[model samples]
Target: MELETIRETYQSGRVVLINKPLQWTSFDVVNKIRWHLTRALQIKKIKVGHAGTLDPLADGLLIVCIGRATKMIEAIQDAPKEYLAAIDLGATTPSYDLETEIEQEYPVEHITEDLVIETLKGFKGEQMQMPPAFSAKKVNGKPAYEYARKNIDVTLKSKKVFFHEIDLQYFEPKHLKVRINCSKGTYIRSFAHDLGQKLNSGAYLQGLTRTAIGQFTLKDAWTLDQYIDKINRLNKYKVGEL
Candidate 1:
């Protein structure tokens, strides 16, 4: 439990893949898992690192590398991801999701299932998008989220992203469920935000769950507690014991 003890026994750069829990920052989970690993093995600290960062508001597969496996993080992030997201119409927000306050609202009387069908077809393509300022993306040497916190306006440049496929599951006038297969940097929040813009109706992400990332998926991910316990259980085994 002491810092020095951890430094002594913990190795650095091991790869772990975990399913992040809702409301816990990636770092919080990392540190908690670190504690679990040390306790299980009766060691100080094991070198552990994580792959892609998932927003606390989102939950899904997060690839982690412990010890030398840490080198694979970038490779993992480069892979595409799939998501099942819900877009709530008739409202708009600064951050595009539940992260910020609702900034505007629109009438939904004119929205229809037919319109939803037509609009979804239009989103299937390569396009340029402005990353949300409330995101972790860096701008001018500082995180855009930091700038947003200080109420400073940040200019974000548009970047190309592809939506390989978007299947409409359910579409009500005010709510829509969609399955999206997109590139690495794609933000479903931004996608929903823009969809509202194109339709001239305000919208925000009501809910989101990452289904797949590259070859990994939620179904294949270890729940947070399960993974932490795994580390504890791992130490009970001997080297070359697998």
Candidate 2:
């Protein structure tokens, strides 16, 4: 579609899939898109929101809704999500991911490929999961990470989440790669943390990529540069129209 046509649709509403860059928070994507659209369309304001929140350390598909489409954010977020995650065995961090420094290490000498495969099976289906302390989950109307940073302890309850599939893609002594398809609210960081405990070795999320959210795939999403270029094109076209 032409940039102008896209801009026109966006004024009312449109669902855009963006390939989120690593280290950029989900809000970053929304803000960027909104800023660009407002400039391209010469509009005073634009309603924009994201369907799901991707961690700053992860990258891949992010569903963005503009204008009236923002109302569908809840439905979009409820859909299943898929992720390619790299789990680091034998070491753990306070956040269960590289967002925090490793606080402890364990022996991986006893871990084997067969054992890892067997252990993965245990995570499939419905289970209760405790979200990481350094997460966006709210506690007493404040983000959990806020309290965690203050060195305050808060008891977080477990939530039910379902894992439809857990495909082990690779395995080594201390590195494991897996593709996970799970329900909403399923936290991959927590999964890695729990897996380490089950294996008698510490583990944390070394890497993560959100490959899909429902029918939206990273392959169809626009890169930040591409999105900006299109917006520029639209703005130029708007000048021609005037």
Candidate 3:
């Protein structure tokens, strides 16, 4: 499609599926796209927002809404999400993920593959999950992570979340790979922590990737560089041609 056509569509509103890069916040992708769009379309400002917040340490599909499409954010966020997570057993972290150093360790010698599989079955269906301290959840009008980073104690209430499926994809001593299909607001990091507790060992999230959100899949998403390059190519199209 021509630059002019793309610009018009964006102005009218559109949904973009982005494959978020590792260590990049969901907001980072939105900001980058917004920056490029304003410059490429020669506009002072344009509305851009993401449907769900993906942790900076995790990577994968993110749904970004542009212009009038921004109104779709809430609905999209309500959709079910799928994730592939790697849990490192025999250890616990303050942040429940690699964002923090290992705070403690436990023996995983007794944790067999069968035990792991049985434990996973217990996680399926509905349950209340405590949001991690290092999360975007609000606490006294501030983000919970702010207090966590400062080592301040704060109470986070458990919220209801549903897990439709929890499948153990790979298993080895001290490590596990699993696929999860869950409702909105489910936190995989917390799941990792909880799983460890149930198994008489400790665990932390080692890696995570959001593979799908509702009907959207990572396979159809564009990389940030790919989208940016497409926008940069717009400079070659003259206003007179449109």
Model 1, runs deviating above 4 Å: 1-15, 42-45, 235-242
- Model 2, 11-58: lDDT tens digits are 667788888898999998889888887887777888999999999999
Q: What lDDT would each prediction earn against the true structure? A: 0.79, 0.90, 0.92
Q: What is the C-alpha lDDT profile of model 3 across 1-242, one tens digit per residue?
A: 56566677677778889999998999899999999989988788999999989999999999999999999899999999999999999999999999999999999999999999999999989998999999989999999999999999999999999999999999999889999999999999999999999999999999999999999999999899988886677756554432
lDDT, candidate 3, at 100: 91
**Deviation of model 1 at 99, angstroms:** 1.7
Model 3 per-residue lDDT at 131: 96
Against the true structure, candidate 1 reaches a TM-score of 0.88
All candidates in order of TM-score, best leading: 3, 2, 1
Q: Deviation in angstroms for 109 in model 2?
A: 0.7
TM-score to native of every candidate shown = 0.88, 0.94, 0.94
lDDT over C-alpha atoms for residue 90 of model 3: 96
Reference-based lDDT, residue 238, model 2? 45
RMSD (Cα, Å) for all candidates, in order, is 3.9, 3.0, 2.7
lDDT of 1 at 242: 15
For model 1, residues 1-242, the per-residue Cα lDDT tens digits are 44343333345445555778789888888788767766765666566666677788988777776656667778988888889998999999989999898988998888888887788888888988788888989898888999998899989888999888999899888999999998888878899998887777888988888888788778877888877665565635443331
Between candidates 1 and 2, the one scoring higher on lDDT is: 2
Provide the clashing-pair count of each candidate structure: 17, 0, 0
